[model samples]
Target: MTVAEIKVIAKEMGVKTSNMKKVDLIRAIQRAEGNPICFDTHSRENCGQEICMWRRDCN
Candidate 1:
């Protein structure tokens, strides 16, 4: 997803994203959703979270 879209999601989640990078914003969002802050850290491209919303971009 684009930064704008991510920012929107962050906004809805009450996260301040004005100065956050893409990765940071995504991790923050995950924390807000009570998920792990594991964005872009899939070592083998095989994440265990089957229903992860960030799967498409979390390479």
Candidate 2:
């Protein structure tokens, strides 16, 4: 998602988005949701989270 879109989600979740990069923001969001902070970690090849919402955007 775009930074703007991610910022919206972050705001709703009470995550401070200032000065945060997209990957960091996403990882923070994942942490907030009690999920793995695995975005762009080069784990996609072994990441079996097919139903994850961030799958498409993951590297």
Please tell me which predicted candidate would have the highest TM-score against the true structure: 2
After superposition on all C-alphas, the RMSD of every candidate to the true structure, in Å, is 1.5, 0.8
Model 1: per-residue Cα lDDT at residue 17: 96
Q: lDDT tens digits, residues 8-42, model 1?
A: 99999899997899989999999999887889886
Looking at model 2, which ten-residue stretch has the lowest summed lDDT?
45-54
What TM-score fits each model? 0.85, 0.92
Could you give me the TM-score of model 2 versus the true structure? 0.92
Error of 2 at 13 (Å): 0.7
Pairs of residues at least 3 apart in sequence or in different chains that clash in candidate 2: none
Total residue pair clashes for candidate 1 = 0
